[model samples]
Target: MLPRSGDVLHVTRAASVQFLRPITFRVIRVLDWPTYDGWLWLDGYELNASGDAVSRRSIFVQREGLHQVQTAPQHRPHTVRTARRPVARTPVRVG
Candidate 1:
């Protein structure tokens, strides 16, 4: 399942690059959603080993490096095409 915007995610250190501990994050935006080996972009405050939020904001994590806590519900966009009906033709009166 792909995570949608405004979804809170708990990223683990094992899936991180610098952080050596579990960090809670929120899904800001999704860069790509493929059938396999897809990438996920996230942004949140940096947390210390003690799970304290740091001053650093706009922390972006992408690619296979970051992992989401849970797969957010996929918000499928509504795609419905409306068909046009044929109009009746009126005969013109010529003088």
Candidate 2:
């Protein structure tokens, strides 16, 4: 984590976090140790309810301290059209 601070941290990871308790103080503070890292925290009901986020590789992970250059759009069109829809009659979990 140290290398990314000033190229001090070599690796950065984005992971899910759950906080069980509520702090009564109106103001809040979050401190990090020597590691050069960041957070992607979700609080309770707001966490998994959104279909946009799932259990696996759910979030877009990117490297910090690096700028992302926009890429040109691809010239090819999508192989499938908008009318395509998957059959929804599949079985659900029995559990």
Candidate 3:
């Protein structure tokens, strides 16, 4: 699949020999540079286990070997609570 901006991928040795160690990558954009058939050059970031970007990089891999990561559904919005005001009391007159 053609990776687009914001796509998360699981890159491994299957993608390319350079990636002996697997990495979680977030795509910044797909590079348009020419490459051999079935191969592509991708511009993106290396993501940590927590899904945070650790570094920026460009990778070369086979399109058939690239795996897209499925992102979790968005969280529900929190409900707003209305606060109640305290009742006011009248002061007593002094003699």
Which has the better TM-score: candidate 1, or candidate 2? Answer: 1
* Top lDDT hit: 3
Shift in Å, residue 8, candidate 2 = 26
Quote model 1's TM-score: 0.39
Give the residue spans of candidate 2 off by over 4 A: 1-30, 36-46, 51-95
Best by TM-score: 3
Per-residue error for 83 in candidate 2, Å, reads 64
Task: Write one digit per residue (lDDT tens) for candidate 2, span 1-95.
Answer: 11121111111222212213211111011223233345321111111323222222112212342131222234577577578687779778996
Please list all clashing residue pairs in model 3, or write none if there are none. Answer: none
Q: Per-prediction count of colliding residue pairs?
A: 0, 7, 0
The candidate 2 region of ten consecutive residues with least summed lDDT is 2-11
Q: Is candidate 1 or candidate 3 better by lDDT?
A: 3
Using TM-score as the measure, name the better of candidate 2 and candidate 3.
Answer: 3
Query: Taking the tens digit of each residue's C-alpha lDDT, what string does model 1 give over 1-85?
Result: 4556655556655454655666676555655434244434444445455645564344434445555554557778999989989
TM-score of 2: 0.15
lDDT for position 12 in model 2: 21
TM for every model, in the order presented, reads 0.39, 0.15, 0.72
